[model samples]
Target chain A: MMDYKYIEQLLERYWQCETTLEEEQILRSFFHQGDVPEHLRQYNDIFNYESEAKSEHLSEDFKQKMIDLVEEDTAVEAKTITLSQRFAPLMKAAAIVAMALTIGNVAERAMRENSASEVAGAPVIADTYTRTEDVKATIKVIDQNQSAIMAKADSVKTMDLIDEQPEIIE
Target chain B: MKEISFKNDILPLGDLLFRLALRIVGGNRPEAEDIVQDTLIRLWENKEQLADINNIQSYAMTICRNLALDHKEKFENQNISLCETDHDRADDHDSPDKALIKKQQYETAEQIINQLPEKQRTLVQLRDIEGKNYQEMADITGLTLADVKVTLFRARQTLKEKLSRLAQ
Candidate 1:
């Protein structure tokens, strides 16, 4: 008692392109059995054709050939990649060198400016907090200058006085 | 959408792709072979984006289909014979009577299918033969869901009517 009615309905659904993949596969499996009922025999070829077609494939060597071909492309691409790789290290070194030189020059200029300022402002920096010996040396130099000027004034005053006394005697 | 490596995942699809190319270009195995190889190479070229695709099988199938049709168009433009049915290839393993019947069926099925426009022909091959679902069909053929159904329905109807006519 084969289920002819179910097969018929499935066939109808199949022709309408409405069958699920499992249902369709079932149809194929059913047709694959050697003794498809008379009405289904004609449809057997159609279902079997799909399986036969699926078995068709390219040659075994094709994969290797394709790999070779794709690798050839990769070789060309790798060449360009290597070219970029080669320049990368050089560019990096140049950038590092430039950075080092800039930092070194800036540091040297700062050091030079500090030394120059130390030389230029050495007296001012010392005088702001002069030691007692430094003050005594400055006071001594000032007293010497004052004494010389006083001595010259005394000589001039004496000359004037002598002239006045002579007039009185006359 | 699992991870798809080009060598691990995509390169193995060559045979599947070859079948699709053979179907689209009407059984020119050599051209289909070249097209399949070219499609694989193209996949390799675009391997960077292979993982981004939701389905690598359908993606490769689609590329194989387009390249096959492109080659078919160029083949047609050259005014060469586009019909190259390889029925003899099926004869090697079948029993004599069975092989005869298969060859006849194959030739008839091919004749009926080749009469169709490329889309419907490919739709039939993808659906009935490949057993691909509607969405995969849509993805491979670049057709909308409704259009895939309509086209596949039409192809099925045409096959039914034609096969029945041959029976009668």
Candidate 2:
């Protein structure tokens, strides 16, 4: 008993592309309610299909996959680093430590020989004090050199860590 | 300017883009899925440039459409025709015969729309299904408003003629 004249008019305009978006929506809504009169039943499929098509969507798994892909791309490094390249700074630090130990041991031996000679030659107090000062100066210079080498090694290690943080986070 | 978060802003457009891609690539789900994935990845990679864009959804649609067209061209042999059955659930109150008829009608409707050319089908998907305005369709499709109307008119006309015959 409902008048479908308005719907028929909208359908005509819809085919002509004269209906506004809202009017088109009204037509869709009308067909979606079902129970179309015999004359309107044929148009039912078109609106129903459009309505059903709107439900077509990518799954949540697909969404998660896409997010993982984007994150992976951002996490990966463009320039690949080999194992040797990664540990090169560590190798340099180890070498510096070994050289410093050797130098320290040699300096200790030289100081031991000098003190032994001084003791045997009836060393004067002033001369003994000067020899002690020279040994102290040599040890201090060695310590400063060692500290500088360790500082440089530490900075290089820090930089390497910074560069590798992205991979680590991934 | 509002900041664009990939999860919130870009990723939500996935379903919309997927639907568009599906229509463009002739209902090949895998191909359509690939197109959407590529489109999202491209958008995320170039998200820095997206901050200035007025409508990111429309912009994403454009990118998605172009990628779909390229993918279709590259694999011309595999652009299988759309024959997917509608997944729409039958109304619980409907009788079995009515349900089957409704299902067939929906399938026929899909077949009719799928028969349209790529441009016309895409325009139909955007306007009728996606409920996009003419201006938005023009912006997404790179067509003038008048051209959008004309193309949509032609597409709808074809649908009308075919549907009328179907009713008869």
Instruction: Quote the TM-score that chain A achieves in each candidate.
Output: 0.46, 0.51
Write one digit per residue (lDDT tens) for candidate 2, span A115-158.
87778455576688999998898777777766665776687866
Tell me the tens digit of each residue's lDDT in model 1 across A1-170: 67689889999999887899989988888886667887677676677777577777777788777777767776777443677788999999999999999999999999889986977578766776678676787777667655655675577765554333222121
Listed in order, each prediction's TM-score against the native is: 0.68, 0.74
Which residue pairs collide in model 2, if any? none
Model 1 chain A scores worst on lDDT over the 10 consecutive residues at A161-170
Which stretches of candidate 1 lie above 4 Å from their native place?
Answer: A81-170, B1-6, B77-94
Error of 2 at B56 (Å): 1.0
Runs off by more than 4 Å, candidate 2:
A79-170, B1-4, B85-96
lDDT of 2 by residue, B1-168 (tens): 677777998999999999999888878888899999999989988888999998999999999999999999999896555655345466456798888887787778878998899889999999999999999999999999999999999999999989889777
Residue A76 in model 1: lDDT = 75
C-alpha root-mean-square deviation, candidate 2:
24.0
Q: Which ten residues in a row have the lowest lDDT in candidate 2 chain B?
A: B83-92
Candidate 1 structure, TM-score to reference: 0.68
Q: What is the alpha-carbon interface RMSD for each candidate?
A: 1.7, 1.0
